[model samples]
Target: MILVTLLSFFISLSYETIIFCSFSITITIFSLSFISKYPSTYLVDYTCCKPPNTLRSPSHSFLKHSRLNLSSNLESVDFQMKVLARSGLGEETYLPPAICELPPTPSYEASRKEAELVIFSSLDSLFNKTGLNPLDVDILVVNCSVFSPAPSLTSMILRKYNMRENVKSFNLSGMGCSAGLISVNLAHDLLKTHANSNAIIVTTEIITLFYYTGKDRSMLLPNCLFRMGGASVFLSNKKSFRKQSKYLLLHVVRTHIGSCDEAYNCIHEREDSEGKIGISLSKKLTSIAGQALTANIHAFALQILPTTELLFFLKTLIVKKVFKQKNTKPYIPDFKRAFEHFCLHAGGRGVINEMQKELGLSWEDMEPSRMTLHRFGNTSSSSLWYELSYLEAKGRMKKGDRVWQIALGSGFKCNSAVWKCNMDIKTSSDGPWFDCIDRYPIHVS
Candidate 1:
């Protein structure tokens, strides 16, 4: 009986060995077939065989260390990335009691005081919400459309934060509201090179400094439209740091239209003899924006989505073509399929209304933009984030969700950025915007 049992065990072992050998041969053959079908590129680090965070074959300790060093090196590459920070500097220096009242006769000092208040007030709103420490920021970029402060806004931020001497900085003025996204586009490029770097961007329009208190309704629009606003956004390319970040940079599209006088006339600032500064909105703005959006959309379509999806979109366009439909609106690309949240620019009642009419978005979908206009009164470039904050405040943002922000400004430009949410948005009851979020969808005059 013992001899019979041993023979059976040996037979079973032989069968198992044969099966293992066959499986190994099949895998080797399949691997060869795959390698032959694909071209090799040195640019790819072929070692990342699995999706992010998936367990894989162990690497040699030395190889792991080398990869870490390489990633660290990438972070130092000289590139531009827009960041939002150092608003506190502007807040501390400006505002009530310091310069209690406006001067009866206009003076540059009054403008300076108002500008200072604008910068600081906007900064205070941003930093208080973000809870970011001043010293931790590695780069600074600032944009003030009309006023360029002495010592440069960028330098002031560096001094206020006591940032490292080696930290990079940039200040942009007269670029208009679209300048904010341009700054962001630059920042994204910088981060692609410097993986560990963090950049801060502060965006505000001190229209009070350029206030047009003239009799012309065109000049008076600034007083009714422009209000105080500032926003700070932190950007990092380090894979480890992005796990909880609000949005991932997708694509940025810019178009320069109507150059020379005709172009500049679309959205330009001019002052009367009394030194009352104001922004003029031409009747042609809507048309210029339409053309620019068409161009921008085509450019954006080429980058983020797959060729098949693009083909499908084109086919839909062909099938649903409209020749002279009255009250025609821009095609609202299936953003539901593309993004989970929408932070459309809160330029004004007309701007918001036009976008909603064009995109066919419901009032619920436009909660953020509408609420911002009501509370903040069109904060210009920084208005987008305030809208985003509203969504976060309402506890509506979820992980793996997406956000789309579209801004319209000078040059008749319409710029947008897409963000993919990395985690559930957490709201603090302490926010200034918290109580008011519940009362949105209000009528705007």
Candidate 2:
């Protein structure tokens, strides 16, 4: 009798173990399914435990019944959609040797001359490529961060292009990389309000004018940092022009930091002992950028899909915990999920590395960005657009493809713009910079 009882006890224990394993497997499968569906449905939070007060009702059918009740309460609504178009207004020339290698160790006079020529040559090249009538422009937005022309860059563009009298114009000063997208956002608003209006946005920074005059090691940084860049983006509300435009304005997110005097120290324009004006960039710029990204992305993700959040979480955990490297930062979202192409800001080698680390992206992922930096240096606000053009030049974009363009500028702000590809991307013959698409994955020295 005792032997029989022991045998039965062992049999029961084995059965219980099987049941436990099956239950665990079922839960695992459920979790995977939940994650997969979370992207499409807003019902993600259900897979996890309910918060403090929401779990009071313990019926097995409570979750399903709640979903049924919510669905039943839906109301129908109709809304009209508005769209804006921004066209790549041809390519422009960049006189790198002239700006970076001026004579006399780069005194003020040489700097001034380089600045003037940069503006002149860049505008002329852009107009020629765009085949746009200069006098037809209705609004002008010109941003020359460090070197605002004496009569203003806006006036210069108008005079050279022979723009009409009553042409509305605004010159943005000292608003770094964020300025370009800000200009785009402004144009979107203006075009939406007015009918048959064309808004021209010109982004360029004549770094030659702001080139360091002193031998101060701190001042010497800009000499190595700033690069020649200028671009013209034409925006309009006309639906007919939308089909050929490279990117439709999906959404723009902007986050401003360092608003107060102390916080303003995050980024500032200051002078050296020689009274020469120089933009003092701080090492803290990266930390500020990370913070801004968190805020901007948080707001964006709420409006976007939960898949974005999950991807962000996975990338973050893998990079922060599994990698166990101090230099390694949390992963930025796999932009590939939301965008077919990426135009990350090519601020510097270090900046590029940080972005790559955070995103868990390979060097190939940053090819456009790295190439932009190598070829044009930091073109300020226009760098992201240049990267986009690089991808287009390579024939990488296909219809319905999406792009994520990110920019970091003064005020320690990080701004992002999403674009969708509508048509075949063809290489332009008039571009100031050519894409060595065949020789990409280049050795990054």
Q: What is the C-alpha lDDT of each candidate?
A: 0.57, 0.59
User: Highest lDDT: which candidate?
Assistant: 2
Q: RMSD, each candidate, Å?
A: 21.2, 21.9
Q: Which digits, one per residue and each the tens of the lDDT, describe model 1 over residues 1-445?
A: 8865744443344445645654675566557645532111110000000011121111232123223323444322111010001010111111122112222223556555554554555555445545656676666778778877787877866765577888778888877777778778777766666646677777766554554435444554444455555665666665555554566665677766646465568777887566656687666665566566555666676454333344444434443453233454334566455667788777666667667766667887787887776666567787787777777778887877778777777866678787767677677564446555677556544
lDDT of 2 by residue, 1-445 (tens): 8865744443344445645654675566557655521111000000000012221222222223223323432220000000000111111223343332313144545545554555555556555655556776677887767776578878866777778989889999888877888787666666666666767877767665565444344444454445556666766666655665555666678777656443357556788787877677676666666666666665665333234344444445444554465576554555556666778888777677776665567878788888877656667887877787778667787878877777888777777777667677676543534534555545665
- What's the lDDT for residue 260 in model 2? 41
TM-score for each candidate, following the candidate numbering: 0.69, 0.69
